[model samples]
Structure formats: C-alpha cells, structure tokens
Target: MSPTKLLIGQIFIVFAIMVLGVWAATQWCAAMLGYQPQLGQAWLETWVFAIYRPWQIFAWWYHYDAYAPEVFDKAGTLAGASGFLGCAAAIAGSLWRARQASHVTTYGSARWAGLREIRKAGLLRPVGKFLGTYAGRYLRHDGPEHVMAFAPTRSGEGVGLVVPTLLSWTGSAVIHDVKGENWQLTAGGRARFSHALLFNPTDRRSAHCNPLLEVRRGADEVRDVQNIADVLVDPVPATDTSGYAGLSDSIDRHTWQLLKGVALSTLLGVGTEISFGDERSDLVRALRQSAQQNGARAGDQIVGRSLDIPPTLEVRPGWPLRVLVHRDVVLRPWRQGGA
Candidate 1:
C-alpha cells in the first residue's frame, strides 16, 4: 500500500484500539461494581448531566443578571459561576500542558521546518513524515532510560535495533549504553559508569547472534541523544519498489507523542505488566554473555554482526506501547537523507 493509505489505516486502527479499550474498561468497572453494562452508559450520562447542570444555572445567571445580579438564587448562581470558572481554569491548565509539550520538542530539535512548503508537497508527504519521525520511544525509570524504535534499519533489509541509554536526567539527558554498562552521573563525585545490561531482545544461542551493537562511553545530554536517535527513528522504506517512492517532507513528532502518551497512560492505568516470567533470568544472562564476549574494542564501537530480523522480539518486562499489525508490504532500502 502507499504511504498515505498506510497512515490512514494506522490512524484508524490506533484510535479504534483506544476507543475499544476505553469501552472495555468501562464494562469491566461496571462488572466489578455488580452493575450491568448499561450502568456504564448511565455513568457517562450522569457525568455529562452534571457538567450540563452547571451550564444551565450559568445560563439562568447570564440572562437574569446581565450586568450584576443584586438578588437571585445565591447557591445555584454561585455553583454555576464556580463551575464556569473551573472550566476556564481547566482550559488554561490544558494550554499550559500543551505549551510544555511543545517546549520539550524544541529541545529535542526538528529535522525540518517550513510547514507551508511541506503542505504543498501532498498528503503522503505528511504521512511518510509521520512514519519516519517519532516512531520510537524513551521509556524512563529510576536508572538509565531505554530509547527504542521498532522501525526498519537504514538498509531496510530488516527491522534493526538501536538501544541507547539516557545517563543523567538533569538539564539534558546523556545517551550511551554498551557492553552491559551505561554512562551516568554521581552526586558529589565525578561521572560513574554503571554496569547493567539494559536492553536485549533476542536469545544469544539463537540464529541471529552477532547483533550490531554500539557503545558510547562519553557523557552528554538530550541534544546529543537526539543525534543518535535521529538515525534509529528514521522510517524504514518498504521492501517493494513500487507502492512507495521517497519522503521529502519532515515528519510531525507531536502526533506520535500525543498518541504514545495517551496509550501509555491508559496502559499504566490498566496496570498491565507484561513480563517474560521465569525465563527473564535466561534473557538477562544472554545479555551478560553477549556483553562479556566484547573483548577489546576501540572508542565506542562494539564489534559484532548485525541481526537480520524484524522487530518482533521484546526486551522483556516492558509495557505494551502500541500494537502495529500492518498487512503484507515489502521493505525496500531507505534512500539516504530521505527521512
């Protein structure tokens, strides 16, 4: 399929999953409360009615007290006024959050600008742009954070892996992980390199050994991290030569941010902990073995053969970010500088 059609299909699927998940949640809640599924509808209606009730009172106040009502339903009017004020505050809060999100992107930096030029290119431009940019994530916890992308490799032969580490979570984030260690900061001391095999998606004894692994021993910030992330996050081209050509326009990172944010929030809210179970030890061991195999290497390069496989393997014990089940479409080599 063409990039435009692919994007439209993905948008619909992602949104449908979100809508269905919400509906399912409501039904589950009702069941737990010993109520019928209709109760879910009733609850929604009640909430809407409550918000509408305040509006009704506000309308009453508006007409009666056009200027300033000296005499009226004091309690009802006060309630309506408070609700109206609350709604305004909520809107302001939302704007503040959006502004904050926008600011973060500013720090992340953009690969391109000039929105008008991009719009003129056509719809596929934006869709391909969307696919190219922001198709990955930075999952953070107490220690080093994991930056992942399920997109195709630069070669577009297979879905490759680019696992980088975010060192310190201060002014900016430093990203580098290799040989079972991460670059991190220490309090009242110099930078300390912590030993921990952060992310490994496959078994060592498996056919796809000798994976392409790179390690940066230096400490940097978010600005630096983006440089490495940019390469990994670039949308992989379809193997087929015809259906798609190339991408000229820049991808909008905000769309993925919003979708991932909502999906993650819902996943966490639902308390979904996808674990690899007792086999986790073996996976971690595989990572350790892989790390140990790294004998001597110059600077940051960890010499190993690249894995030729799709992004089907999981790193273990991570939440399901999103489900991408697309139909049959070959992956062609990505054109240099296209993303």
Candidate 2:
C-alpha cells in the first residue's frame, strides 16, 4: 500500500476498534444489570447479542443454573477494562507534554549599571535633564529619612528609560545646559526651557563628557554584560523585533511607548528595593531618530526631519543627577565628535 493509504487505513481501523469495543462492553454491563432481551427469534442465540442494552446483557449473564458457567465478556462499553485504560493513558500523556514545555527555558541581563560607578561620573546632573517626574519614596522603618528620585522616561519624553536619581529629596539642584537648542536651564530659575539654545551633540570620545562602563567579577546576579555596563556610543535599540514583521510600523510606536512606560514604572511596583547616594555625574547620552523627535510633544513644530535621541541615561545606577535634553541635540557637530 502507498504511504498515504496506509496512514488513512490505520486511522480508520483505530476508530472502528473504539466503536466496537464500546458496543461489547455495553452488552456485558446489561447482562449484569438484569435486563430482558427482546427480539423476533434470536432469544436463544448465543453468538448474536444486543450491544447497546447493557441491562439486558447483565440479565443474560446472571445465570442461576448450577450446570451453567458464570462468565461475562465486556469489550465495548466506556467503563469496560480496555475503554477505561485507554482514556487514562491519553490523559497521562498530555500532562507529560505540558511539563516538558516549561522545562525549556531562556535567559538575559538587568544590571546595565552599577552603584559605585554611577556615583563617580557626576550622573546626577545629566540624569536630571531627562528625569522629569519628581518621585519621593520613603521607608516607614527609616523614619523621616527618605529617597527622592525620578525615572528618566517619566519626563514625558518619548525616550524615557529605566534609571533613577539618588539625591532629589534633600532640596539641592544645579542649573546646567548641554544641549542648548533642545532644552535650556533658565538662568537662576527651576524652569527647563526647551529649544532655547544651541545643542552641541557630538561623538562621545570627543564630547569628553561621555559616560563609560567598567566590568568586574564577584557579582551576585549574572547576565550578558553582568560584571558592568557597556558604554557604546549608541543606546539600547529603541524597538524590539520579536513581534510579527507584518505589523512593524504599528509595533514601533507601540513598542516605544511601552518601553517608555516600563522605564518609568519598573521600580514603582510598590515593593521594589533601591539604594541612594551622593556621588553623581553630569554626563548624559541622547539618541536621535531620522524621522522623529525624542522629547517633543504632539504640538511641537518640526523644523526638519524627526529624530529619536534616547534620554541622557546615567552611565551607571544610583547616580545623583539626571539629564533631559530634547531630541534636536543631534544636529550639532559635537554629536559624532563626542560619541
């Protein structure tokens, strides 16, 4: 027989066998249940018997004659020896498959920054530029002493990310401007004016103000780039590619917004543990997209092509300062030269 025919024949045979088994079991149960058999002329026939009438089969099998053998045959009913065992085996096989799926695991990293290094780079100032939402978290056990901070992404900028400031609670701040035309710190005031000055974004190595990462051993949590953060001229890829390709553009907008939200809310989940410090750096990093602006709002006028410079993220975690320059920071020569 052809392979295809053999496969079809096997499937047909299996189904036929199941139906036949159910019929046989039903006849046995009926005999044991004291059922009366009805027919035109087969009442005395031994080979031919009703399959669906289990009660009748039981009655036939309930022999009281001393000379007759007390024997029962069950092959077709759902509760018969064969039928019950088949269903039990099927259920057991399904459970084992599910267990195997969970055992197939995958992995990644979260320690993109460290506590000590974030302190040395004067991260507080640069981080503040990007961290707009002022957050104050207090521990009941620590008394009046509490930590005031903000995530970079909460500043309402599209590039919002997952780093926090360490000192914002003690009422201390400084006015400094790096991306002039993108955002400016009002002289002697707390207001951060946007698009008021010239932005001198350049390459990191040339910018000198670029943040760097250092790795080391003796870590508790390990992952790719675990020992320390990697300082690349570019930041994390703004969009993820794991989703379906057919819906990419829609996914791009959705992905960026989701990343911004997560970067803002990751530590706000009520039970997150955090630390604070006084050391911080003023260096900040920003990424610019060719078709969109990173920090501008819907009403903000567009002068040229849109760009997405990621938020001025801290070089390490637990930095005292943060930065928040607009996306326009890319148009300056300082950009490539500083990267």
Question: In lDDT terms, how accurate is model 2?
Answer: 0.35
Error of 2 at 211 (Å): 37
Error of 1 at 101 (Å): 2.9
Q: Per-residue lDDT for 124-180 in model 2, tens only? A: 343232333223321111223433445363363323321122122223333243443
TM accuracy, model 1? 0.14
User: Which candidate gets the maximum lDDT versus the true structure?
Assistant: 1
lDDT of 1 by residue, 28-109 (tens): 3333334433222342345223112212333434554544344334434444454455455556655555555543543555
